[model samples]
Target: MSDTLRIVLIVASVLCLLFMLRKISQSKVRIDDAIFWIVGAFVLVIISIFPQIPSWCCDLLGIQTPVNFLFLFMIFILLVKLFYMTIRVSQLESKVKELSQRYALDHMDDEVKQDEK
Candidate 1:
């Protein structure tokens, strides 16, 4: 990687790590959600400090360059996160629907008794 790219990656990763730490301390983000950002920042810092890691990965993956490998790595990580988020959202939607139906059933008799009065 170029000097500029290395510097930017290191700076950005450190900033990200710090931001995640602050958020965790404030209870702004769940540990599960923040885990990805924390891990990604560490991976980035490692690659930035030792550029040969990406260089070797590029050769193994048959990617044209180290930069391409880095981007692919990031995108893969994001895609996995997105998939998990989708699954979680689906589970939440089903739970909400179930709770709403149960609530309506539980209250139906009360509504009828009030109307009868």
Candidate 2:
């Protein structure tokens, strides 16, 4: 790779790692999401420094080309992140719905008790 390209890649990778670390440390991030981001950042840094490893991995996996391996790895990690986010969103939605339902039920009960009095 050209020196400029390599430098750009390195900078971008580091930035991504920093972002992941920040997210992981934040209270807004769930444990599972933080873990996923951390693992993704780890993989990115690993693959970026050891380009040959991707080729070797491709060979072991019976993939046709080194670039294919890189692409596959990236795509796989992205999909994992997507799935994690989907699950997290689902959980949050469920919690919100449950809380709303509970609030409504309690309020209705309170109104009924007042009406009885």
Candidate 3:
């Protein structure tokens, strides 16, 4: 990897890490969610520090270049995170639907009791 790319990676990773930390401090992002970003930044920093790692990975994966490998790696990680988020959102929606139904039942029972009284 070129020094320019290395420097850019390190800078970007540090910025990302810092941004996530700031978000966590502001209560804008949950720790679990920020964890993915934090880990991603760490990986970026690692690759920046150890160019050989990406080179070896590119060779093993038959990728044309380290830049291509980096892009692919990042895209894959983000896609996995997106998939997890989709599942999580679905689970939350299910729970909300269940709770809404339960609440409606309880409300109906209260109205019926008042009517009988």
Candidate 4:
């Protein structure tokens, strides 16, 4: 990558890191979720500073280009994150449904008792 491009990437990564930290501080983002983004931004800054690391990874993996390797790695990470988020959402939905059902049953029981009295 060109020096200019590397500098741009580093600046962007730093911006992203700052944004994540700000969001965490504001409670806009959960710490667990922010951790992934923070780590990703740090990795981006490191790779931008040491472009050779990606190249070395590409060579080790027999990949043709550093850019391709980075894209592939990023896609894999995003997919894993997506899968975990899906599971978490499903669990939350289930809990909500269960709570709703319990609440309805409790209310119905109270109404029935009042009717009997």
Candidate 5:
């Protein structure tokens, strides 16, 4: 990769890391989610600084080019993250449904008791 591109990537990664930290400080992002983003940003910065690392990795994995390897790696990471988020959302939805049902039942019982009185 060109030096200019590497510098840009490094700057962007640093900015993202800073943004994530700010969000965490403001309680806008959960620690668990922030951890993944923070780590991703760090990895990007490291990769940008040491472009040879990706080339080495590609060679080790028998990949043709560093860029292709990076694309594949990023896609894999995103897919894993998406899967985790899907599971979390599903669990949250189930909990919300259960809570709403319980609340409705309690409300109905209260109304029935008032009517009886």
Candidate 6:
């Protein structure tokens, strides 16, 4: 319930959401994957915002009672995953663009040949 814990959770949730949105906007995710990630993000936000949830989890896991550590750990993980996802999306986009350009060039050559005939 400290200010730092609250801030950490908020920042992590925001970063995860923004990352996901960016990928989706870039056409990285299909409809089903988008839905799944959206739901997962929502769940993460809910868990981060509710301190009691972490407290309960700690109790169940027989871990320490400090939710701050949990928040920090979760944020770190989310950031790493975001970075990985962004890199993958960028690579896929590049591949798609490259393939599309190659196909268009081939089609254009075929059209030119037909015209010459």
Best candidate according to TM-score: 5
The C-alpha stretches of model 4 lying farther than 4 A from their native spots are: none
TM-score for each predicted model, relative to the true structure: 0.85, 0.73, 0.89, 0.86, 0.91, 0.47
Q: Write the per-residue lDDT of candidate 1 for residues 1-117, one digit (tens) a residue.
A: 998999999999989989999999999999988888888888888999999999999999899999999888988888998999999999999999999999999899889999999
Q: List the residue pairs that clash in candidate 1.
A: none
- Alpha-carbon RMSD of each model: 1.9, 2.8, 1.4, 1.7, 1.3, 5.8
Q: In model 2, which range of ten residues has the least summed lDDT?
A: 1-10
Positional deviation of residue 7's Cα in model 6 after best superposition, in angstroms: 1.8
Give the top-scoring candidate (lDDT): 3
Q: For residue 97, what is the lDDT in candidate 6?
A: 100
Candidate 1: regions farther than 4 A off: 112-117
lDDT of each: 0.92, 0.75, 0.93, 0.91, 0.91, 0.76
Q: Which ten residues in a row have the lowest lDDT in candidate 4?
A: 1-10
Model 6 ranges off by over 4 Å: 66-117
- lDDT order of candidates, top first: 3, 1, 5, 4, 6, 2
Q: What is the lDDT of residue 111 in candidate 1?
A: 97
Candidate 4 lDDT (Cα, whole model)?
0.91
**Sort by TM-score, top down from the best:** 5, 3, 4, 1, 2, 6
Q: Is candidate 5 or candidate 6 better by TM-score?
A: 5
**CA deviation > 4 Å runs, candidate 5:** none
Clashes of each: 0, 0, 0, 0, 0, 0
Model 5, TM vs. native: 0.91
TM-score of structure candidate 4: 0.86
